[model samples]
Target: MKDLRLIFRYSKPYLRDLIIAVGLLIIECAFEMIIPVLMSTLIDEGVPAHDMPVILRQGGLMVVCAVLALVTGLLYARFAARYANGFAAELRLAEYAAVQKFDFANLDHFSTASLVTRMTTDATVLLNAVNTGLRPLVRSPVMLFMGLGMAFILSPRLTIIFLVATPILAAMLAWIVSKVAPLYGRQQSAVDHLNSRIQEGLTAIRVIKAFVRGDWENQQFDEVNTELSDASTETFRFAVLNMPSFQTVMYTCIVCIMWFGGNFILTGNMSVGQLTAFLSYVLQVLNSVMMFSGVFLQMTRSLASARRIREVLTEQPDLANADQPVTEIENGAIDFENVSFKYNAGAEKNALSDITLHIPAGATVGIIGGTGSAKTTLVQLIPRLYDATAGTVRVGGRDVRDYDLAALRDAVGIVLQKNLLFSGTIRDNLKWGSPDATDDQIWAACRAARADEFLDRMPDGLDTDLGQGGVNVSGGQKQRLCIARTLLKHPKVLIFDDSTSAVDTATESGIRHALAQLTDVTKLIIAQRISSVQSADLIVILDDGRLHAVGTHAELLAHDTIYQEIYQSQKKGGDPQ
Candidate 1:
C-alpha cells in the first residue's frame, strides 16, 4: 500500500477526471441494483394480480434505469481511460527525466534494459490495472452495502447468511493475496530479465552473426523465455484458484437460501415478492464480492509495478548542481590536484590514484597508457562525468562543482572511443553539437575532421541518412563524422579518447594537423599509438593507474625508461617491453 501511494501521486493532476469517473460509476451501480428489485416486482406482484397497467409501468421504469446505467457506465469508461492513460504518460515522462539526471555512477546502478522495462512494461501494467480496477473499486463497496441493506429489509434471516459467509470469504481472499503478491514481483523480474536478453541480442546481432553464435544465442533466449513462462504460469495458477473458491461459496449460499426461503414462503412466513427480492439482493452482494476478487488480482500485479516505479522516482542522482553555480567558463585550462577516483567506493584499488597534472589554456597534451591505465577516466573528470572521490578537479580555474553542469559540459567537447550516431541525416547528426550551426560552419568542421572528403564522394553528401547507430558508414568514417560533430561546438577544450583509432595513420595525421590550427582551443589526445601524440607539447605516461612520467616526446625518450621502451618498440615494429 505504501508503494501504491507513489502511483496515486502521479494521478493528482487528473483528479477532476478521477472524481467524475468514480461518481458516474456509483450512479451506474445504483441503477444496476434497481433492475433486480424491479424484476422481482414484475414477477410477484404484476403477474399475480393480473395488473396490466402495473406491469407496463414497472417494465418502462426498468428500461429507463437500464438506459441510464448504460449511459453513465459509458461516461465512466471514458473518464477512466483518460485518467489512466494520462497518469501513465506522466509517470513515463517523469521516469525518463529522472534517468536523464543520473550521473555515470547512478546509471551503473541500474542496467539500461531494466530501466526500459520500468518505463514501458511496468508502466503499461499499472495503466491496465488502473483502467480495469477503477470502476469495480468504486462500485463494489456501494453495491455490497446497498444490496445488504435491501436484503435485510426483505428478510433479516436470509441476510444472516451473508454475515456468516463474509468472514470466511475474506479470509480466503487474504490468503490468496498473500501468496500471489510475492509471485507477481518475481514475474516482473523475469520480464526484466527477458527484455534484457532481447535488447542485448538485438544490439549485438552483427557480432553474434560474425562469431557464428546464432545457435548459442537462440538457446540463451530459450532459457530466459522458459523462465518467464514458468513464472507467469506459476503466478496465474495461484490466481485462478480464487474464482473457483469464490463461485463455490457463492453457489452454496444460493442453494441454502432457496431451500430455506421456499419453506418460509410455503409456511406463509414470507411473501413470494419478498423472497424474490431477497434472492436478487443476495446475488448482488455475492457478485460484488466476486468483482472485488478481480480487483484484488489486478492490484496485486500493479503493486509490483508500483514498487519498481517508486524506486526510480525516489532515487536522488549522485551528481547535482551547486547552489551558486558559475554559468561561464573563462578558459580551457584544467587542473587535477592529487585526484583519486574509484568506480565503486568499496573497490580495493582506485581507477586513478593521486593524479596531478595541469594543462594551459591553449597547450596540446598527449596521454599514453596501457589498456587498464585509466586514460579515459582522467579526461572524463574535466567535464565532471564522474567526480573525484578524494581531491579536486578544476576547469577554467574554478572547481567543476561550482559551474552549472550544462555550461561546464558545453565548454568541453569529447569524442569517445565507441562513436555513436543516431538515425538521421549526416547534417542532422552534426547539428546536435550546435543546433543552429550554418551550412558553412558544418562544412568547415567536417573539413577539419577529414570527414568532408568522404561526404563529397557520397551521393547525397550531408543529406544522406545514417541508419541506426550509423551502421551505413564504415568504422573510420563514423569516428571522423563524430569528430566533425564535436568540432561544430567550437568548445574551449576538445578531447579525443582514442576516437581516431579506426582511421589509417595518414588520415589520422591529417586530422591532427588540422586540429593544430585551432591554436586557442586546448587539446587532449589519448591514444595507444606513440606516433599519435609524439608531437604534443607534453606527453603524460601512465602505468597501473598512476602517473609514471610527464614530458615532451624527445624529453621522455631521453629520460624515461617506460617512454623510451614504447618509442623504440614502435620504431622497431615490435610490441612494447
Candidate 2:
C-alpha cells in the first residue's frame, strides 16, 4: 500500500470526477438494494393482499428507481472511463520524460522492452484497476453494511446467524490475498522478461536468420512465454479459490436464515413481509460480497503494477544539477584534468585512467588507438555523457558539468561511430542539426562533407525519402550525411568518431581537405586509418586507455615505436599513398 501512495498523487487532479463517480455509485447501489426489497414487498404484501392501488404505486416507484440507477451508473461509467484514459496518457508522458532525463549510463541499465512495459502495460493495469475497481470497492462495502442493518432491523436472531459466517469467510479471503499478492508480483515480472525476449528477437531477426537460428530463437521465446503462462495460472488458481469458498459460506448462511425466519413467520413472532424482506437483504449482502471478491483480485494486480511503476519513478538520475547550478559555456577547447572513469564502480580497472590532455581552440587533433584503448571514452568525457570518477572534464574552459546538458552538447557536435539517419526526407534528417537553416546553408554544409555529389544524383535530392537508419543509402553516403548534418550546426568544437571509415580513400581525402578549411572551430578526429592522422596538427596515440605518444607525424615517426610499425605497414600496403 505504501508503494502505491504515489498513485493517489497523480490521481488527485481528478477529485471532482472521482467524487461524481462515487456519488453515482452510491445511488446505483441504493437502487439495486431497493429492487430486492420491492420484490419482497410485492410478494408478501401488495400481491397477497389483493390491493391494486398498492401494487400499482410500488411498481411505479420501482420503475423510477431503476431508471435513475441505470442513468447514474451509465454516467459514472462514462466519466470514469474517460478520466482514467486521460490519466494514463499523462502518466505515460511523465514516465517518458523521466526516462529521457537519465544519462546514457543509467538508461543502459534497463532494456527498451522493460521501459516500454513500465510506460504502457504497467500504467494500463493500474488505470483499469482505478476505474473498474472504484465502483465495486466503494459501492459493495456500503451495500453490505446497509443490507446487514436492514436485516437486523427486521430480525436480530437471523442477522446473528449470517454474521457468524462472515469472520470465517473473511479469514479465508485474507489467506488467499496474502498467497496471491506475491504471485501477482511474480507474474508481472515474468511478463517483463517475456516482453524483453520478444523485443530482442524482433530487433535481431536479421542476425537470427543469418545464423540460421530461427528454431533456436523460437524455443527461447517459448521458454519465456511458458514461464509467464505458469506464473499467471498460479496466481489465477489462488484468486479463484476465494469465489467458491465464499459462495459455500453464503449458501450456509442462506439456509440458516430460511430455517429461523420461516419458523418465526409461522409462529406469528414476525410478519410474512418482514421475513421476505430479511431473506432478500441476506441475498443482497451476499451479492455485494461477491462483487468485492472481484475488486480484491483487481486490487492485487494493480498493486503489483504500481510497485513496478514506482521502481522506475523512484530511480535517481545519473546526472543532476548542483545546489546552485551554473548555466554557461565560456570556451570551446576541452581539457581532461587527471580524469579517471570506470563504467561501473567496483569494476576491475578504469576505462580511462588519470588521463590529462588539452586542445586549444581552432586546432585539429587526431586520436589514434587500438580497439578498447578508451579513445571513445575520452572523447565522451568532453560532452559529459558520463562524469569522471575522480577528476574534472572542462569544456569551453569551464568544468563541463557547469554547463547545462543542452548548452554543452550544442557547443560540441559529435558524429557518433554508428551514424543513424531517421526515416524521413533527406532535408528533414539534415535539418535536425540546424532546424532554422536556409536551403543555401543546407547545400553548403552538404558540400563541405562531400555529400552534395550524391545528393544531386538522387531523384528528389533533399526531399528523397530515406529508409530506416538510411539503409537505402550506401554506408559511405550515410556517414557523409551524418558529417554534413553535424557541420550545419556550426558548433565551436566538432568530433568525428571514426565517422569516415565507410568512405574510400579518395573521398576520405576530400573530407580531410574540407576540414582543413575550417577557420575557427576546434576539431577532434578519432580514426583507425593512419592516413587520417598523418597531417593533423597533433596526433595522440593511445594504448590500453593510456597515452603512449603525442606528436606531429614527423615527430612521431622519429620517436614513437608503435607509430613506426603503423607507418611501415601502411607504406608497404601503399594504401594511404
Among these predictions, the greatest lDDT belongs to: 1
Poorly placed runs, candidate 2 (over 4 Å):
323-326, 467-471, 570-574
Per-residue lDDT of model 2, residues 52-161, tens digit only? 88788888888988998899999999878766776777778778888888887878778788888989889989888877788778877888888988888878888898
TM-score for each prediction? 0.97, 0.94
- Candidate 1 lDDT, tens digit per residue, 1-577? 9888876898899999999999998998889888878877887889999998889988999999999999999999999999999999999998999899988888898888889999999999999988888877888899899999888878888888899899989989998999899999999999889999999999999999999999999999999999999999999998998999999999999999999999999999888878878888888788888988889988999999999999988888887899999999999999999999999989999999999999899899999988999999999888999999999999889999999999999999999988999999999999999999999999999999999989999889999999988988999999999999999999999999999899988889899999999998999999988889988999999998899999998899999999888887788985232
449 Cα displacement, candidate 2 (Å): 2.4
What C-alpha lDDT do the candidate models reach, one value each?
A: 0.91, 0.86
Please give the distance, in angstroms, between residue 8's alpha carbon in candidate 2 and its true position after superposition: 3.2
